[model samples]
Target: MSDKKHKTLCAYVEEELQVKDAKSFISLIQPATHFCEGCGRSVAKPEDVCKPKKLK
Candidate 1:
């Protein structure tokens, strides 16, 4: 079993935001930074990111 836990993009953002309000959070995430595993950099859209599969 792997010791590392997998988190969605949203989950990772939420952790960075801490206890911010909904409105502020929404505003902050309006332009979310999605990392492209293939390119190894940030992207404009989540679709550009190479998402990992969920372990069943």
Candidate 2:
């Protein structure tokens, strides 16, 4: 593996979904999944962000 440290940067993607039983049809924000550049792993949700630190 490379010595490059993996960091979890803040990121998001826009998504649209159909809703049932709506009056005026308002928009909703949903949690999106993101991938890590170093590990190439998928982050579960936006709330659970993995913040990594650099080694001096």
Candidate 3:
């Protein structure tokens, strides 16, 4: 989706991320530094998620 707003873990496009950017997703998830309070998705950087809450 070209018109997608934010490029966060929670905003991922299934086909786009799975097929094209799966590696990116995997890397973003492991060793995650922050997790989204809104969607429970984790990412390396706070900016990579919607509601980023620091990992304990």
After superposition, which runs of candidate 3 have C-alpha atoms over 4 Å from their true positions? 1-6, 13-16
Summarize candidate 2's per-residue lDDT along 1-56 as a digit string, tens digits.
12255323222221111233122112111222454445443444432235422222
lDDT of 1 by residue, 1-56 (tens): 12176434355444654364555445433455655454443434565345632212
TM value for model 3: 0.70
Q: What TM-score against the true fold does each predicted structure earn?
A: 0.26, 0.24, 0.70
RMSD of each: 11.1, 14.0, 3.2
Ranking by lDDT: 3, 1, 2
- Model 2 C-alpha RMSD vs. true structure (Å) is 14.0
lDDT by residue (tens digit), candidate 3, 1-56 = 35456577766744468568777668768888898999888788898787899999
Output the number of the TM-score-best candidate: 3
Candidate 3 Cα lDDT to native = 0.77
Clashes of each: 0, 0, 0
Q: Least lDDT summed over 10 consecutive residues: which range in candidate 2?
A: 21-30
Spell out the clash pairs found in candidate 1: none
Model 2 spans > 4 angstroms off: 1-32, 46-56
